[model samples]
Target: MPVREDKRGQERVWETRGSLPEPMLPLPFTVRKTRKETHDTYTLELQSESRPGGLAFAAGQFNMLYAFGVGEVPVSISGDPAAPEVLVHTVRAVGPVTRAISGVKPGDMLGVRGPFGTRWPLEDALGSDVVVVAGGIGLAPLRPALYQLFRRRRDYKRVALLYGARSPRDILYRRELGRWDKRPGVDVHVTVDHATEGWGGNEGVVTALIPKVEFDPAATVVMVCGPEIMMRFTVIEFQKRGVPSEKIYISMERNMQCGIGFCGHCQLGPYFVCKDGPVFRFGTIETFFGRREM
Candidate 1:
């Protein structure tokens, strides 16, 4: 069986080719490869221990990664969902836990627990015009969704990507972004908040690029991620253009204490960002979304 069927006869779709013990436990995975993505950021590719083959995860879900002796942090899974042979995560080291994770070298062993949280609603987005808005590291979580769309191009109408970063040096997946921008039927517009020598991209926030892209706001499904403030403003822009709140989705980055909803650290009003979301339909959480300090 490609997946394990429980006593009740429900199929476990997330089982890797060979499968592992359980999804909730921190399964050991050896870092197989690493790539430097900017000065302070890197991406790690891991192979599961003893047949932890390709881990199945929806786009926008995260894994709680434990760097032996350092700490654990919730990081988005940033790989193609169709390929199930490797696990990937792109991280920007800003805190102690993340710093330790970025310091890991190939062949090092780490523990991972997840494929948690909701997805980007790629299924619902099919047959509709698609607008993807990302800021800085926010692009990491959206990478998989883009991969799926391109691989199955006939499933959607027009597609556009609007990305903004703090600076040219801060752009994540620069090489891939270039390639994607060149892909037929995909429109990519990237901007920067600030620039230095040799930089020639748009000099503004992400929302500015929104108005510049051509899409039927009434027919588009929007997916946005970044700092909470950026998402708030991006949503407002889409709303002004006639996109309904129900069609706008945003990924929430919170201080996740536990991958499960047991911990209250990621609480957002009545919902737990870790379990109930991390990705939420803007309409569902619209009232409390822009509230101060939430």
Candidate 2:
């Protein structure tokens, strides 16, 4: 049996390859703890049994999470690489699989497949201003990029994050966002589509907040992740502000069954969304952006 250790100092027995009929990828991991950040959002802290080594990935990469007998889903690594042993993922309970994940307890066993997909170009953004725009639960993948930037604060120029959700209560990573707001070189602006009583923040579509940001188009990279419609409008807005199409990067979401390229479920035209990217330069994917049935 393969044993996995968790953050809270507990170990669980994981079935080894010999115990199963076919070979299995036994990535020994333990569920450290589960915490609810909001009414429906939860974060899981997973610890690796071995002394964790660096996960060589650019920011914005995602991993395939496998529940013992349930199913698998692609989730972003929301933790920083600076501390690799303990991995963190912020998940929202929207469906059966995710709800099962949310129900996981400390010391539970789970499997992980990758740190796959094309990553956000943090190196390209070096010395250039960055504009990160997120909508709804789309902020999950962007969290890695935010973590990387703040971890090495001097690598990039001014950085700003514009996030939007249905209501103030729906916002994810409220605690981390609060810390980002207080950071000297970062500006975090948030908005809601509808306002509830006593809400004091801006109330409007996320695009409405873009006009207030100050960044030179020629020296900035805009990274966006959101609903297809939201991204469409965001690209248009960036164009109006003189930001080149090539400079804008966007993370696309699709029904990904397998993290590897073998699955056809995540195909987009000639490119496999799982292999080629979940993140792509806007100009590289503009043709498929408006397709009716992508």
Candidate 3:
């Protein structure tokens, strides 16, 4: 049994002996395949031994991915959560944990905790225009949103995606990006900061793509993720378009030790990024935006 302190400061047993978090909704999944998207980016596809039962989630939620001994990290569920048996995660090899994840084989075991976090406002964007801006590996978190919109292509009016990478070789999800470009009612634009000889796309910051998007400021939802500097500039671009800050959502990245709220490593101002959000409407954090170190 585990004891917890209540608001009255009295200890209470929160669980009975030998009981564990409702049997942990375990699904036996195996890595179907792994694809290297970039030098450091990899996509892992996990398939259930059989079709999973009733696994569903909103567009922007994430999962805590566990690799045997390397520990766990909260990664956006890149696949359609509705098809829970076929889960996918796109990860960048930025640290030891990620490297370990990359080394996992087809038969390896991985644990998934949840489809956590408040999702992107998919329902609110119905019949409205949407602009998705991503930079570098930041695009991983937006994959689900893209899938949801495309899955129900008739629900929305127009959708545009603008993604920026550091170099031509750094682009992630090239295949899917190409597919999205060909889809009806969806426009996908890709750019790189430093172009190589073979590169023919736009060669500038992602903010440069903002002017090309067509949307009504009052009826649009802008979802952005990337490095802090990229997000700062993207928000400014949205402001220039007269979009309300409240209508723009941004995913914030931080060091989250415990996927749950127990550990405070992911705290930002009055909220915990791991709990209150990894995604937040710009206006909700507007006061503390760009002031973390100041």
Reference-based TM-score of each model: 0.92, 0.88, 0.87
For residues 68-107, write the lDDT of model 2, one tens digit per residue.
7888788777776556557778888888778888889999
Q: For model 3, how does the per-residue alpha-carbon lDDT over 46-82 read when each residue is reduced to its tens digit?
A: 8655544423555566666777766777787777755
RMSD to true structure for each model, in Å: 4.3, 8.5, 6.4
lDDT of 1: 0.85
The global Cα lDDT (0 to 1) of model 3 is: 0.77
Q: Model 1: which ten-residue window has the lowest total lDDT?
A: 9-18
List where candidate 3 sits over 4 angstroms from the true fold. 1-29, 48-51
Q: Look at candidate 3 and give me any clashing residue pairs.
A: none
TM-score of model 1 vs. true structure: 0.92
In terms of TM-score, the best-performing candidate is: 1
- Give the per-residue lDDT of model 1 (tens digit) for 1-294: 133433422223232221334545678889999999999999999988676556778787888898887878899999998885799999999999899889889989889888777778787799999999999999999999999889988899999999999999999999999999999999999999998789977998999998778888878999999998899999999999999998999999888867677878998888788867788889878978989987
Ranking by TM-score: 1, 2, 3
What C-alpha root-mean-square deviation, in Å, does candidate 2 show against the real structure? 8.5
Error of 1 at 237 (Å): 0.2
Of the two candidates 1 and 2, the one with more favorable lDDT, higher being better, is 1
